[model samples]
Target: MSDVSTRVDIALLGIRGGSTPVHRRSGAGPSDDGHVLIGGFGAALPIRSDSPYSLAGNKLLLDGADIGMEIEPIGRPKFYDLQTADGVSYEKIAKLHGSNVLATTVVQTCIRYGEDERCRFCSIEASLAAGSTIAVKRPDQLAEVAEAAVRLDGVTQLVMTTGTSAAKDRGARHLARCVRAVKAVVPQLPIQVQCEPPGDLATISELREAGADAIGIHVESLDDDVRRQWMPGKATVPMSEYRAAWAEAVRVFGRNQVSTYLLVGLGEDPDELASGAAELIDMGVYPFVVPFRPLGGTLAVDVDHASAPNRDVLEDVTRRVAKELQHAGMLGSDQRAGCAACGACSVLSSAGG
Candidate 1:
C-alpha cells in the first residue's frame, strides 16, 4: 500500500477487465477511467481491453502474473438508476466519481472547444454530442440528483465544473447558483467549484459566499509555451491573470482550499513543471499533478497520438512536487471537496503531498 509505483503504472497503462467495470466514457473530469480502490484509496485507471494489467478476484496481474497488488472495482451508484421528475436521467445530471464523490459538468459545451482553439487534452463536449449528458444542467436537476446520490450512495461531496461560456462571468454565476441549490437540499455537503478565471475577480467572492467549500482554477501547465501548444484557447488568458485569480481565490477560500491542475507530459520540462508546482504551493494552491492519459476522442489521442508520460518522469516529478507540498503542509486531503480531496487521479496523495 505504501509503494504506489504499481498504482501509477495501472493509471496510465490501464487495466483490462474480465467483465464490464465501473467506468466513465467521457466529459467528466476524470473521464475514460475504471473507478476502483487500490489498497483502500480511490483510483481512476483507464479501462483498456488489451492492457497487460488485469484483475482476477482481488489480485492485480501484469502479463498473467500477480504483481502483489490488490484492487476492488467501485460499484455503479444507485442514483444512476433513477430519473428526475421531468424524466431526464439522474445520471445525465450528475455521476459518481471514485467511491463517494458526485461530479458533473454544468455546461457541456465550451466556446473554445472548436478544433483550432480547443485544449488538446479536453473532450468536454463529446458526451453531449453522444447524448450521454445534457448541454446545460439546471439547478433543480442537480439538486435532485445530488440528494439521491448522498442518500442512496453515501456521497460525501460534490465537484461541479462548467465548460467556458461567452458571458463575462465565464460560467461562475451559474456555478454559484448550482452550489446554492444543492446546499439548500444537502445543507452539510461539501462542494467544490471549478472554472476559468472570471472576468471579474469579484465573482470569486460570490462563489465562496454561495457555500463553496473549495475551488479549482485549473491551468494545466505553467510553461507558457506548453500552454500555447496544448491549450491554445486557455493560453489566451495570460498567466498574470491566472496568478491574480489564484491569489483572489486563496484570499477568499483560504490556504489549501484553492487548487489547480499541472498535467505531466505535453512536452513540459519535468524539473520546470515541478518548480512551477512549488510556486503554486507557495501561493496556497494545491497543484493536482497527473500523467496525461491518451483518452479516446481527445485531440491528443485522435489527432496527435500522444501517449502517457514516461514512468520515471512521472514518478520523479510527483516525488519532487510532493516534497514541496510536505514542506508547505499542503495535503490533498485537507481540501474539503473536488479532485484533490478524492486523490484518485494523482499519485501525490500516496507520496504524502
Candidate 2:
C-alpha cells in the first residue's frame, strides 16, 4: 500500500489540529471545521485529538510524519469584521464556505427542531442559540453581505439554505426574495437556493426565474427506512414529494445543475448506497456522497455516540458513485454553483466523481 495517504484517506481518519484557526465550532447538518483545502480544493475532515493525520504549516502529516500535500485552512473572511447598517455582524448573515463560496441559513429556525421531530443528525439552530447567527436573515441584509463578501474576499458563488418553514412554500419563496435581492446587487455571482420541496411545484421555476443558477433539493437518503429512522420529521414529507421536487428541479435548473446529499455514515449498505447514487445520476441528479462527522449539539453525538462510518466503506462507496458520475459525465465542477460545485463536505470530487 502507498504511504502517501490519499486526500480522502486523511479526510476519513481526520486530523489532530486542536489549534486550527478556521474551525467551525457549531452549525447545521453535514459538517463543521468544514474548510480544509487540499491541493487547492476543499475537504471536510473532523478535528480529532487522536487523529492519525495532522496539519503542520500547510503540510499534511500522517502519524507525525510530513506528507507532500499542501492543505490550507480557509481563514475568517474579511467581511466578517464588518456589521450591517442596523448593527448586526456580517458573519451572522452569511459565512465563508470552502475557498470561494459564501453560505448561510436564511431562516435559521426550523419547524422540525422539536425533540421528537428533529433530524437526528441536525443542529440547524445551534449557531442561532449560541448568538453567532440570527433567527432570520432579511433580503437586504443578504444582498449587502453578499456584495461585501464578493468585493472583499473574492467569493465566486453563494449557497443559501433554510430550515423547513410551516408555510406552503417551505421557504422557497423567501429564498427567491433573498436571491433576487443579491442578483440585483451582484448579477455575475452564481447563486444556489436549497430548501425542502414546496407544496406548490411552481416555486421551483420561480427560484430559477429569480436569478438562481442552481438548486439542491436534498433528501439525504433515498431509502425510506433510512429516511424514517434518521429524519423522522422530514421523512413525513413522503418520497413522492421528494421525487416530484427533484423532477421539477431538474426541469427548471437542468441536469448536473441539481444535486442532493447522500451521507455515507447513515448505515445504508455501501453497495446499496452506490446503487441509489447511480439511480440519481440516471435521473440527472448529482448525488453528493459525504462521510458523516459527529458534531456537538446533534442527537447522533449527544444521544447515540455515533462515530463516523468505516473508512473502507466510505472509500468503496465513493469510488463506485464516482465511476457512475464519470460514466454519466456529471462532474460536481460542471454545476454552476452549490454544494456539489464547492464540494468541500464530500469526497466525491476528490474521487473525481
Which candidate's TM-score is highest?
1
Model 1 regions lying over 4 Å from their true place: 18-20
Query: Model 2, range 299-321, lDDT digits (tens) per residue?
Result: 98999888878878887888889
TM-score of each: 0.98, 0.97
Each model's C-alpha lDDT?
0.90, 0.86
Candidate 2: what lDDT? Answer: 0.86
Top candidate when judged by lDDT against the true structure:
1
What are the RMSDs of all candidates, in order? 1.2, 1.5
- Global lDDT of model 1: 0.90
Candidate 2 segments whose C-alpha is farther than 4 A from its true place = 1-5
